[model samples]
Target: ASRTETVKSVYDKMLNSIKEKKTAPPNAWLWDFIAKCSSKEDIELLFDMLQKLRIFRLSSLRIHENFNTALCREVTKACVRVGAIEYGKKAALWRHNAFGLTPDIGSTHHLLLYSKQLNDVNLLVEVMKLVKKNELTIQAGSADIVFSICSGADRWDLMTKYGKRFVLSGIKLRQSSFDMWMEFAAKKG
Candidate 1:
């Protein structure tokens, strides 16, 4: 069978298991299938299955720490691939909020990467705000993305703001991040 067919078959089985109140497959298995989704239809189906898992309160599908982070990143990337950029943002935020998982830096990092890809300063600012609002711990990788975005957009103000924020938070940014910030500052001056 084609890869799509195989993925669909797995999706159908997972959905049916939930509907039948049977022991659903493990979340890791579902995550593997989620990673396999390539098309918009497949992603939509994946979202539907995720919703079913939530609604059914499937004991087998318990979300552990970092599981939701991985799931959100995959879902966001899948949606972005299908030209559903807005949907990707919503799905990521929904997954973050819905799961009650501790605010994770990885989830925001994925969003920042996409915002950088789109050269979307507004989206970058929104993600930064979300990070602050949720008090998500900032990591070097996330700081790198923010610096990249600010440099790309020539938004030295943003770079300075987040640069100070990172220093204040005692997060040691990478050399590359510092290089980008310095280069951008020199360019602006």
Candidate 2:
């Protein structure tokens, strides 16, 4: 296949055109370029350029308003695909906090795993805060993520609180979760 338009090609075109004209990229072309990305790298490249433009105050409000929930969802999906869990959480948080997009179960799972994998208790706390602030339903799978965060962060108080809550909620704790609590209990005794 003789490909005329590629991600790099589109990026180069946009960059060059913007540089020459000192104008914001047209909304349609910009969104089209973003939508045509075939890999995570392309998405990151687009974000990099957008970030630079935003920092320099060259971006348009039209773009921001147009971004809406769909762009945030794309960023979340792309970040996870690229193993950029930190970025994924950032995107998810921005989507909810900035754009007022409703949180989905998948995003909850991503934030939960990202917090544990990144060893970021604050991110995990942010996830919980969002749920409570929004009054979202807590799924049983949340217990698993809470256990992981508590175990990794050594937040025994949270472990104790959520552990009892898990039992009361009828969610079976993993063996390792129980082990973490037992270890904490032994230390406290």
Candidate 3:
């Protein structure tokens, strides 16, 4: 079947499942498929469906070269609503916006990755400040992200600062892991 037809079928099935207050296996598959959509209309439809279905995993969506500002805005808003703000950070890394959209902890963590990926000291520092300022929670899995970003950016100061914060957040780092992170942060710095 054509893409439109397939999406329609998936939407119909998903709507039925929602009406019955049940999650169908095929609905997950449909979400997986929709996340890959690059067509503008399809992507919008997918976002709408996402809002309706409450499917929030953004590790599956792949932004592309053709994605526009409107699409990016929609994605960012959807990510925020679904608690997938990390994905929004990836989108922001690809394109900057003058309009403020304060990223959540998940997005800040992703922004940290983007900063390291682009070697953008300014962006990295900006994200670090947000996390440091208590605007964002250093949630679970954030420690790993901090370690990776610090390793990439060779940002020992922020690493030490955030690492200490992570320790205080009650994440039990293995003694070896803690030592290794410190060593790496030092070496990179």
The number of the candidate with the highest TM-score is: 1
Pull out the clashing pairs in model 2.
none
Please report, in order, the local distance difference test score of every candidate based on alpha carbons.
Answer: 0.73, 0.63, 0.54
Q: If scored against the real structure, what TM-score would every candidate get?
A: 0.77, 0.50, 0.44
- Could you give candidate 2's per-residue lDDT for residues 1-189 as a string of tens digits? 112257677777678756786666665665666566656676667677656455333253334332445656665665665566555655565434433233455566766776788888877777776655655556567777887788768788877876776687566667766776777778667
Question: Candidate order by TM-score, highest to lowest?
Answer: 1, 2, 3
**lDDT order of candidates, best first?**
1, 2, 3
Candidate 1 local lDDT, 1-189, one digit each (tens): 775687798888887777675665677768777778777777767767766666555355564433356667777777777656555655655335433323356656667888998999999988787677766778889889999999989898899999999999999889999899888978988
Cα error of candidate 2 at position 182, Å: 3.8
- After superposition, the stretches of candidate 3 with alpha carbons farther than 4 Å from their true spots are 1-9, 12-29, 32-43, 54-141
| Worst 10 contiguous positions by lDDT, candidate 1 | 94-103
Off by over 4 Å in 1: 1-8, 26-29, 58-68, 90-96, 99-103
* Best prediction by lDDT: 1
* lDDT by residue for model 3 (1-189), tens: 777667667766676765574443353555444444545555556546645543322222332223334444545544444444344554333232222223356545545555556666666666566466544566656677666666666777767877787778786765655665868955765
